[model samples]
Target: MNKRKPLDERRAEIVEAGLSVALREGVESVTVRRVAQEAGISLGTVHYCFDDKDAMLRAMGRSIAMRASEPVIAALEAGPDRRALAEATVDALLVGLKEHQEMRLLTFEFAVSGARTPVLREVAQAHLTQSIAMTREYLQRLADVAQVTWASDIDDLARMTALRIDGIELAWMVDQDDAAAREGFAVLARDVFADMRPELPAG
Candidate 1:
């Protein structure tokens, strides 16, 4: 007799299968049948976990955001100084984008789809809020580690930085020009760090 997986494990397995399909074939192809096939289960199993494709897509979107943020959080945690923090953050993001272009494309797909679907839009917004909060905490940690005071509010700086990185990635995806984008990100990092530097006291 074939052993049955626990409900939570089965759900996670189905989500992983859906993510694989989204990453490889685009989010549009993530159907119950396709996911079930990918996960080596019956179609009813996929339906049992998700009400429909929208539910699966939302789950996949959340999973994608979490996976994408891991490297960024690690980079932020690795900072010993402001310079190191900036380098690590920028380098991790750029490297990840180059290596996981498919994941980035799926993010774009989520954004566009969310614009049309109210429920999915809420999911997308939640992901964005989570990202901003995580980034703010990371920036605060960096400041504490480096013993540097920011010229602006750390919260504002974190939000701006997060949005800027997202914009840069979106633009790079469309242009398919990594060299120019890398240079642009380097310049951006320099400017952001410069803006955060506390004004020196008069000699």
Candidate 2:
């Protein structure tokens, strides 16, 4: 009897393969056959793990979002003061972008794909909504802790914050310069939250 690959391992392998294809090429290149070839698995194995390309893309998006969000959420839960929280959030986000370059690229590509593909659009929007909500919650907590009040809408601020971060990631994807991105983010954050400039903890 032939040995069988563990289900979890197989799923992970397929996702990894899909990510590889996405990063090297683009989301447009991440076909089922390509993922199987990248994983050194049969096409049937890939299909067994994922129903279709859209399913694979959705899985990939969720995996990336979860990984990227985990550190940010953890740092927020640590209850840092406002300045520290801002710095930590920026740091975590930048690190995630650097470590998950392929995932970031895939995300951007999927955003474009979402325009033409309803399934892709739904998945992309879902992740984007989750990301925005997570960011909003963190900012609200920070505001409450700092006792800073803003007249602006909190959700709107959060959406803008998320967009700013996404813009920075998009720029870095084109030019991999951590310094530029970090500096840009710092300046932007300060300008956006100019009223609440609490001193950050010593780095």
Candidate 3:
């Protein structure tokens, strides 16, 4: 007889199965039954780990947020300069969006769903807050690399940058125009870096 998997590992496997369903057939299809089927587990097994489908969805959303942050963190670590890092980060984000358009759409769907679901709203807000903080840290690193003092408030700059990226993603969700979106992002990113350049101290 096969030994049973550990609880945490089994839960993670279920969550990933749920994510696969959401990404493929949209969030509406992420039923416990479907996830159980996808994972080749029983419904009772799924319920053993999750109290309900909503709980499983929350876990899946958190997992997605964690997985998405990996490349961004890597970009910050390996980037050469402020502008180059920022550009590389944008490119990475767009590439992911293009590759996982369905996932991108599901994220938007979850956000809209969150407007009515307090728990989900909180989760989404927490994710966005962490992402903004990460971006702020990246900007600080950029300033350090350039050996210049950033003139603007990093908090405001980070928030704005986050908003800009959200807008771009929203546009992609609507238009599905990766080529245009990327082209526009390149120009906008250049202008953004120029605008946020470090201020020179007057002699």
Q: What TM-score does each of the candidates earn?
A: 0.76, 0.71, 0.71
Candidate 1 total steric clashes: 0
Instruction: Tell me which of candidates 2 and 3 scores higher on lDDT.
Output: 2
The 10-residue segment of model 1 with minimum total lDDT is 194-203
- lDDT (0-100) at residue 97 of candidate 1? 80
Candidate 2, residue 84: how far the Cα is off, in Å: 2.1
Q: Which 10 successive residues of model 3 have the least lDDT summed?
A: 194-203
TM-score of 3: 0.71
**How many clashing residue pairs, candidate 3?**
0
What are the Cα lDDT values of the candidates? Answer: 0.76, 0.77, 0.73
lDDT digits (tens) for residues 1-203 of candidate 1: 98988988888899889888877887667778899899999988788888887677767766666677677677867655666777887787788788777876787787776788676786566667766776677677666766677888888888998788778888999898888778777877776667655632344
User: With candidate 2 superimposed using the best TM-score fit, by how many Å does residue 35's alpha carbon deviate from the native?
Assistant: 1.7
What is the TM-score (0 to 1) of candidate 1? 0.76
Residue 114 lDDT, candidate 2, scale 0-100: 80
Better of 1 and 2 by TM-score: 1
